[model samples]
Target: MDALYVPQGRSRRFVEQATNLHHFRLGIFLEVIDLHLQELDNRFNERNMELLTFMACLSPKGNFSSFDKENILKLASFYPEEFSSVDVMTLELQLDVFMDNMLSDERFCGLQDLNSLSMMLVKTKRHENFPLVYFLIKLMLILLVATTSVERVFSAMTCVKIKLRNSMGDQFMNDCLVTFIEKEVFLQVPDEKIIDHFQNMKTHRMNL
Candidate 1:
């Protein structure tokens, strides 16, 4: 279809006039797909996706079907503070034993996820026996949960520091943010206790 593409609610002078196929292929389809790709790139960039893939290798679902010894070892390398060179070398052997222990043990069979696996290891005291594997599982769980929490804090910051409060000092803003984000804990405290605490900070002639 070579007919001139005139978009609705727009004048030809304001919009570029092109063939129908060319306009749809380049302007509409390509632009929409490019935007979606950009959004995906922003959300799950190369590093994040790679880390997620490594994390998935530790999943216990389907009886630890996703487990990969090499990838798990690579994942350990990411946390050198926790896994030293010696620990990493020993972890390879531990992973094999851990896999055998998990596969042979009926208790570990049919486990749902990393959380359940961690709980089961703690409950059965196997975490002590397989400390390295247990540590990796905990790290994976923490990584996932901490990412969500950090994002949530950023979201909360936007709510706490809106345009009207943009000029708030950093220390005051931080205090306000802590109270706002942890409102549940703050709500439990009595107003009188808060007032008394502030009043007692320094000697005062009068108490309100």
Candidate 2:
């Protein structure tokens, strides 16, 4: 335990001298934690963290233990197009009724998540009764799915546009990206149809 810690692939003179415990605590562990914190900060900035907190209020886990009437109302305010000033006023009342109904309802006792809560509400025909709340839930779910889809597109772009293809034009890159990202849909398109469509675009020396 008293032995000095030597980092691999480097000279001891160029590196800081320290014991294994000190090196692991101050160097490796702290550096890894800082990197993780930086990544989290980048991914969840102020706006995103606010949205996440609001969305968590809508979760039905633990019998809606996380539900917050005020936060949900604030979440509705974020989508002014969906909830007008008048609608927000109505939503406040609706939230109260919705909470009461959900608490008293036996069917809503064990909902695991927002998705299950949404499904249960629709299945039990309670969505009609709590339309505003349901709308908020749907909006949260859509935002979650949209964020994932956008990340997927960015990830696909890295794969589709490699170092060799970096010079591709924006329009061509977008077309290729769309095809690559939605390969399942593109795969359903027959090759003959694609060839005929290209052939009909202009006169060709040979029939493609």
Top of the candidates by lDDT: 2
Any residue pairs clashing in model 1, and if so which? none
Off by over 4 Å in 1: 1-10, 18-33, 190-208
lDDT, candidate 2, 151-193, per-residue tens:
8889999998999998999999999989999999999999999
Top TM-score: which candidate number? 2
Query: Could you estimate the TM-score for every candidate?
Result: 0.81, 0.84
Candidate lDDT (C-alpha), each:
0.90, 0.91
Model 1 lDDT, full chain set:
0.90
Shift in Å, residue 1, candidate 2: 4.7
Scored by Cα lDDT, where does model 2 land? 0.91
Collision count for each candidate, in order: 0, 0
* Cα misplacement distance, residue 71 of candidate 2 (Å): 1.0
